[model samples]
Target: MAVQGTPEPFVEILMSTVVALVRRDGPDLSARQFGVFLTVYLGEGPHTVRGLAKELNVSKPAITRALDRLGVHDFTHRQVDPKDRRSILVQRTVKGAALLREIRAIMGEAAAASDEAAPGGATELRRQHA
Candidate 1:
């Protein structure tokens, strides 16, 4: 079933989660890097640099740059596509999965906290702003 609410709460939760994650002493990923990381992990496998660029509506070089940072942290890796010699495939690492799990926990906590802070939750928040 679809969750009923305006987009504001979700955005707020995301912002809070990002802030909390950044505040923690860990790999601090840029927004683009985080986007590329999530797209590779949360989406389908065997993702190509070109495919990621298309998915994110960005240039291939931008994807490459993000991958470079992710690679340094061992959060992701790239390999030549065996099927297509010209293509480079983005692959995930155990560390990436662990990081994502941690992020999920943070986001969940932020969502719960936001819900508790506002009666009727995001719906009420939206109404107040309206």
Candidate 2:
């Protein structure tokens, strides 16, 4: 329990979000898998396995493993870059977009609840950082 008028710690909100996500009805992605998914979808596009590895500071194989799981759910797919066949670009899918929306909604709801519990806190991470 945080002070009624102060910001909730980030971990508390994260844990609550994870709990909420876990209780939801959908494929459960590991931290690495979710991280990869978010980086590809939320961040800039034209993402590649190599680029994802570098961005996430993990090995190409590690990213590949996470992609394997994401691909099973059709959350993302890889296509040979038309401009550079040597590179493989990770592409998003409709299902992936939907999942992203669900995730955002869950997070927003969690944040809003946190805001209500602690009146001084912002309901979004961007505002907290700013």
Displacement of the residue 118 alpha carbon in candidate 1, Å? 1.5
State the C-alpha lDDT per candidate: 0.89, 0.87
RMSD of candidate 1 to the truth, in angstroms, is: 5.8
Residues 89-123 of candidate 1 have per-residue lDDT tens digits of 89999999999999999988887788887647765
Count of backbone collisions within predicted model 2: 0
Per-model TM against the reference: 0.85, 0.87
| Model 1, backbone clash pairs (residues 3+ apart or across chains), number | 0
- Residue-pair clashes per candidate: 0, 0
Q: What lDDT tens digits, residue by residue, belong to model 2 across residues 1-130?
A: 6676454555567878899889988889999999999999989988999999999999999999999999999999999999999999999999999998988887778777777876665545447678
> What lDDT, from 0 to 1, does candidate 1 have?
0.89
Best candidate, lDDT = 1
Give the clashing residue pairs of candidate 1, or none. none
How much is 32 displaced in model 2, in angstroms? 0.5
Segments of candidate 2 deviating more than 4 angstroms? 1-7, 123-128
